[model samples]
Target: MEPGQLRVFAQYDRDLTLEADAVVVGSGPAGAVVAKELTDAGKSVVLVEEGPPFVPAEYEFDGGLSMARTMREGGLRTTSGTVMPTMQAVALGGGSLVNSAICNRAPAFILDRWCSDFELERTTRADLDPHYEAVAKFLGIAVTPENVLGRRNLLFRDGCDALGYHCEPMYRNVRGCRGSGECFTGCRSRAKQSMDISYIPAALRGGARVLTSVRIERVLAERWRATGVAGRVVTPFTGRPSHQVRIHAKLVVLAAGCTATPVLLQKSGNLANRSGQVGENLQFHPGVAIMGIFPELVNPRFGATQGYQSRHFLREGFKLETLWAPPAITAVRLPGSGMALKNRLADIPYSAIWDGIAVCNRSIGRVRVRRRSMDPILSWKLHPADVSVLAQALWVLSQIFFAAGARTIVPGVHGIAPELHSLEEAEVLRDRPIRATDLVLAGNHVFCTTRMHGDARLGVVDEMGRCHDFENLYIADTGIFPQCPAVNPMWTGMALAHRSAQQIAQQI
Candidate 1:
């Protein structure tokens, strides 16, 4: 069935009530997978999303407009005690609609650690292989074609090779990609195979209904069992509350990403946080970028935004990847004022940027609900060890840039020299006392806010993602990850949701 044939309610203005065997909050990767799998098993499902449906034609390539219409908090959400921004998309497909389409399976070591730490004997890598394979096949996951790798990506690969480090082409869920380097904004060509184009459509075809522009305020429970959800429909353009809405289902699945899920549960009078762990242990793959001034034009915005990555330092809690953004976002990250800034803007075509991501950081954060409100108060503090790891990553990125024949490198650190000409000068960066305020940090991956474990005292859900306190309530997002997966969490989160859906089907 075509997408147009799906039952999507986007502009219902009157009070409404929906009923299903399972109602999934959030139409992201996890919720889409769960809905599709359950519908495939002949169960009725309803996928609810807080944001409106946006097609590729609606994308105008304007960063500010895109954020205002599709992103959470108009892309201005930040941690309470720090300047670090927590990026999350609030569309029908959630982050999958705006992300770079990178797909990576969880590493074996990370899976092993999760199994041991969470006592999830049934969640071994072997147990998850089939689910991962299914998701990959469904999404057409493959190594990005060599022709689409832009010059910036090749430069990063050349630098890694010159330094005897390994860099590989990233796997993405795209077909016929034009390499427009606009994935961070929505994909205007619709070439990228996001959840909206893949799983959600399949679910819709298989009898699942999707309701967009509906905010779920609370999960309705009766006698320790999830009965439904209640909320209101908001105006698509302004997000102003408009009409009351309710969804009653035999089972409820919460897949509203890391931040929204915990906050929703907490705001509902701690419905499923029996262990006091609903909004704790939040971890993110915090990343910082280094810009190299090359002599020739790089045209960073001409190809796939992210096409290559190096995990050579994965065990050390960091990874390296090449990234490109539109001139507006790039200018915001570039440091300068007056003439200095103007000069850098003019040199955008000659600048090459790559990110050093600290994936296994020990930093811990939390999400708390403000009294009498649905908003979340998020806070995170980087540990000393994690700060040192970021410093090491900076040193490594500088070396790679220099090896690739960059004349000057600009480490985007506050209270430091703007430009470094030699490795000796870059060495000073390794010793500088790194502070969260001194670095430009961004995180899109969030996990472990409502972790899953066998021990109810330490986790909110069990190994199968079923809430320990309620038989009919389950979680199917990265928020239930036992620990940080040390990689892009999309594929793993979808695979876990598939498993959870299978479990729920068997019980039903």
Candidate 2:
């Protein structure tokens, strides 16, 4: 087999047989890397995905439909009585297709915290630098330059600078972007080098097989050993049901994700590891967007989703990220309807809105078992410290935008848009009461559910990414992160997958 030369085993055209050296579920960065490494090591490998292949020409500009099709739970917004329900992708390339393509490696401070708090080895910046470089090179990560930063992005940079915040160019997994600014939706320009264009093709070239649009219901375990996986094919568009299929494998790697991974584990009735931590310790960088109504058109739809950011408040458990929103979505996010909506939409092309994401880093959330089904009980509770940071971060974002000559600032929180004329109005938020629900938080980055730790009693997976109790089962997704990295996690996810795949290849 060569890259892009694998056969599509249709659901109706069944040819079931599984005796691979390793079976990797979910053909995202994690599964693709694992499969490629295993096949490169001369092991037979099978990769399974839950979404259709990405065709650049067929890509759309609307992120909403993309989120519904490529994300789990249709990117549902849930509050498990603790944390807000966030979005995670289920596309052929997983989150790579939907993310901002920021390829940030693990900061030394974060890695140090991992080493000191979790007692994991080989996670230091020096130890992991080569692996990080290899992953970055593989993804073709590059910094977004001045030519690519459109008016919308430059406006954000100006605001950050005027506020005395450290802002820099972000590295993305893109080759030759034309600055269409539609990275959240599928990239029609074929600039964003997601796993669909990178590792998955390489894996297929190395004789790895891929099966898409198939849902894994449960892992078949025989006396604590994973022997096979069973699931049904999700019919296209019509929501029709289909028959179940079983894949037998000598080794099984679970890259389903933080929420789905533990559910699959619990469904197998293999709860041997009674640490009760397989699905706990979930983390998400709860973000809030500040929409500033500027006199000039911040036609935010003109460039990358996040090209610049404000890191002045990073030590305060939050960072300011400028995000993009299509005009239609931005209309709905406004405070009022009718005349007000028309007024905002009329100037949509000229409106320059500065979006800010308040990165929440101090909260610990979890996933619990629900009924007999494998649906995760998503729950999260924000610490008071995180709430305070969000307040301060939002205040700073508003002040900066105002200093940049903004008229009104619409906080993404679900209340009346705070029509601020001056920075003093923004300062009141610091003392005002803030609640988790009051802020507009999203689940775009869910991590640390099945964390990697040195102790068996504390973490679900070891530093090598193998499960604490199950020998053949492994976790190679965001679920395995011990803590949420301060920046975009896709690159870190890929690097960690590379490291884990190497370990799995050596053993299997």
Candidate 3:
């Protein structure tokens, strides 16, 4: 399909099928990059996605409703007997639509560790620097400016300075962003530079067709060669039901994120045992929040969700990032009954909040493909080290609030009231141990389920992002990230997608 060409619809009842030189599943950051790269190399491409198309300007600025429509499984519920909530976007732009605009590359120290300990070659930051630079330029990545740091973000930086914890404004992917603080619910101004606005648009302009509201079930394989896929396209408006449609292609690329990609490989059956590592070693950078009462109207919802982050404790297995939520969401976390509710609601606009995100250095999980349900089973077990890291990070955050002259500070743990009044009160929190379920955590940065590596026995994909036992099939999503970066995972995911796309373009 070329630009400005006629439309092509794939209907199920008509046994309508389409053939292409390459088929890309999932229209997020990875798939968009892959499709554009392949098509630019003169290969015909077709992209399939399961969620509705989102025009950034068309989406209302409602957090809850937008999250329900764009996020997967209403933000996947962990089945690991822990309340460790994690969320990911399922729309055409994938997580890029519902993520904080912060765009940090994978930390250098983490990459060094992966290469040194895991023996991953050609995976160093130096080797990937050109790719990162290109991606950053394409997304228009830039650091948050001082003028855009709203009062709440300012307070976070001021508190960090007072407490001797280093903090600086993080970089973001945006063009003329007005600091609306609505990144979680999809950028309403269309300035946030999500994949929908950047890569996907460029891909479509380069003559690639994207089909929304299409759910890919499995990769069609024959004699270890992945020829195409079998799936369905629901009615765009009603979404009642539809028949099946199979797509034949010379190449298949999987960009279905950490959960879906692994399950697809496992469900394919022929590809599972070959690597024997699909759906294993899932990693999530669990996040938590802290709120402090301020004398002025801080309006925590005015700037970037995570503009400033603390790097003081990065070596301690914890990374602190500043974040806040909408009034309704934050109200549910505040402590109180009668008098407390009255006091809290009155200070909702004035409350100063900062999220402390912990990128666990040791926690691991698994995603199992259930035969009965199409959705994959998600399970995460928190390690002892993760719990200890949470405790240390919380204590540090509390001390910073106290230093900043906050009289009351609320911890993110469930059922835990504000624990700090004076510096003396904050000292007691350092002694308290945080349990796995006690800490409230939710992060969308997940990876490693379908990790790529040099050895096939330990991972699902090779370093080139190709599946082990299948020819002409590749995984380009975060699932192929062998190690989870201590910071946000989008930049790393996009860069790897670009690399994988180049490899596929060369072969085809």
Candidate 4:
């Protein structure tokens, strides 16, 4: 069968089978790029996604309902160790549909560490710069302009300036953003260059096919070669497994993401476990947010959801960034419910939330698959050392808030005072020993579930993203990173996918 049109499994009444030159799983950043590049190179490609296509106009505006509609597990997926919440988008565009569109390249230090520690060399800046440039140009990536940095985002710069630390506008994968601060709910204006609006459509135009609402259950393989994948169609509303699907192809690219990909591999009879690292070495850029109530109207609802950032403390194990969420979602985490919640909700416009993303590069974790179930169980804990880093970050944020003329700051640490009335009160947290359970945290940037290495015994895939055990099987997602890139993973993920797709094109 030729690859040329979009296919929605929900519309099918029976089993479906397809044949293509290449089959790419998950229509996220990595998979979309791989599919587009292969199709652009004249190969017939079929992209399969478990979730339906991301439809911007149909997105929920309220944060709570938005999560219910777009996020996997209704945004309730949490870590097994620390019990902190994490989010994974379930749409065709994946997290890009809900993310703030921050686009950052991997730092040189991270690349060097991967080269030295993980037996990687082809991932060096010299080898990947062109690919990164290509992806950036296509996505219209650039530093968020000042005009879009409304008062809420500008305050972050004010705080950094007052403290003599440099904070700059973030590079975002967006075009003509209107500062609606609605990035977390999906960009209704189609301004954010999410995969669905960019590469996925481009791939369709290039004759690549997409199948939505189809879950891949297993990999079909013989000896050392992958033949295809088999899965079931999913009913959208009830999420019931309905009809079946099978795709035969010469190449199979698994980009099911860091958290889900390993489970997919395990469910496929533990493929590529020679190194015993399919779901091992999981890492997260865990983040904590502090709310600052300004003396005046900071208008939290109006800004680029997150447009400014401070990477100055990266060596200190965390980086600070501005953040905002709808009042409904933010209210659920407040102290109380009834009128007390109403009072806090009234302060929404006067509050600004800035977050600290703990690099946690040295912290280790894992994702385990249950024997009887195919669901991935995340097992991660905030290390004591990383806990201290977050404490310092919170303290720094308090100081920054006060520096920017805020009256009081909410630290939200369980052991500490609930509200620090002044900057002097915040200094006590500078040396406070924070336990892992004392703070409410969340992580969305997950990495290293199937890392790449030069040696076949040490990693699941090679630097080129080909599985060590099979020439035609590839895994092109954040799972292949030896470590978290200490920033947003989308840009690096796309960069690597671009290079890997080129490599595959050359091979075929």
Which prediction has the highest TM-score against the true structure?
4
TM-score of each: 0.97, 0.93, 0.94, 0.97
What's the lDDT for residue 215 in model 3?
76
lDDT-based ranking, best first? 4, 1, 3, 2
Better of 1 and 4 by TM-score: 4
| Global lDDT scores for all candidate models | 0.86, 0.74, 0.76, 0.87
* Candidate 3 structure lDDT: 0.76
Q: lDDT tens digits, residues 402-454, model 1? A: 88878778898998888888778888788778877888888888999999999
C-alpha-based local distance difference test score of model 1: 0.86
For model 2, where is the 10-residue window of minimal lDDT? 1-10
lDDT for model 4, please.
0.87
Model 3 TM-score is: 0.94
lDDT winner among the candidates?
Answer: 4
lDDT of 2 by residue, 1-508 (tens): 2322453425346634556778888887777778888888888887877666767765656656655666666667575655565876777877787777887776788889888999898888887777778887877888887787777678777877886778887788888877777787777778888888888888887888777767777787788778878876666433344656678887789888777788777776745356678778888877766777778766566677677766666655666776776555567666667787677667566545554444455677777767855567887887777777777777877877887778777776654344555677666666678887787666577788889889888998887788887888888898888988877777777778888888878877
Clashes of 3: 0
Q: Can you tell me which runs of candidate 1 are displaced by over 4 Å?
A: 1-10
Comparing candidate 1 with candidate 3, which one achieves the higher lDDT?
A: 1
